[model samples]
Target: MVFELRPASSADLCFARELTRETMLRYYIQHDLRWQDEAFDVAWAGRENWLICQGDSVLGFLSLSRDAKALYIRELHVIKTDRCKGAGSWAIEQVFSMAREERRSSLRLTVFKNNPAQVLYQRMGLSVVGEEDCFLRMERMCSAAP
Candidate 1:
C-alpha cells in the first residue's frame, strides 16, 4: 500500500501514545513490568517520532534515536487493524535507510521477551545480541551508504 512517514507533531502525541500503550500493555503485564505514561511521554519527547500513514490514516508510529554504535528503534507500533499489512516491514525498511544515511554501523532495538515482533525483526535480519530481565536486544549490521 502507499504510505508516508510524516514527522510526528505534538498533535499526534496522543495517537502515538495510545497506539504504543495498547500494543505494549500486554507485553508489560506478561513481563511483570510497569507501564508508566510519564515515562513514555518523556521518551516520546526525547526521540524522533514518525507517523506511518497511508494518506490521512495513521497506520503506525516509529520512535528512533541514535547512539555512537547504532541507530536505535526505541518504539515501533502498528495499529491493530494494520498489523501484518506490510506497514511494519515498510517502516523497518525506512529505518534501515535512515541508519545508513546517518552512518550508523547497525540497527538496534529491544523487544519484550516473547513479543511477536521479535519474529519480524529476525525476518528483517536482526539477531538477538543480548538479553535482560525482560527484554531481548537485537541488532543487525549494515554498511553506511556512499
Candidate 2:
C-alpha cells in the first residue's frame, strides 16, 4: 500500500486529537475523563508533529524533540488496522535519520513494559538503558567520528 508522510498542521488538530484519544483507549489503562480540547491544544501546540497517511486516511502519527545529545520520540501511534505492518518502524527510522543528520549521538524512546513494540525497538538496536516501574527507556547511539 502507498503511504504519505507529511508534517502536521493546525488543520490536522482535530484528527490528531481523535487519534490520540483512540490510541489511549486501545493501548492504555482506562482513566478518568478530562477536557480533550485543552489536552490536544497543549500537545499539538508545540514540538514537531507528523502524520502518516494513506490516500485519504490517517494511519498514524509521531512527534519528536531534540536535545544536544539525543533525539526524543515524544509520541508515536499506529492505528490498530495498521499495527505490525511497518508503519511504526518507518516512522522510527525517520526519527533516527533526523537524529543522524543533526549529528546527534542517540535516539531515545519510552515504551511501556507490556507493549509489544519493545521487541521491535530491540530489533532496531535500541538497548534498554533504564527502566521505571512499568516503563522501559531505550536508546540507540551511533559513535561519533574522530
Model 1, backbone clash pairs (residues 3+ apart or across chains), number:
0
Instruction: Choose the strongest candidate by TM-score.
Output: 1
14: Cα error in model 2, Å? 2.3
Which residue pairs in candidate 2 have backbone atoms (N, alpha carbon, C) closer than 3 angstroms, thus clashing?
none
Task: Quote each prediction's TM-score.
Answer: 0.97, 0.83
User: 146, model 1: CA deviation in Å?
Assistant: 2.1
lDDT of 2 by residue, 1-146 (tens): 67777999888778877777777644455233354568667867777899987888889888787788999988788888888888888888778888888888999998877777889999888999999876799999965443
Model 1: which residue pairs collide?
A: none
The residue-by-residue lDDT of candidate 1 on 1-68, one tens digit each, is 89799999888888988888899999888878899999999999999999999998989999999989
What is candidate 2's local distance difference test score? Answer: 0.81
How much lDDT does each candidate structure score? 0.92, 0.81
The 10 consecutive residues of candidate 1 with the worst lDDT sum are: 26-35
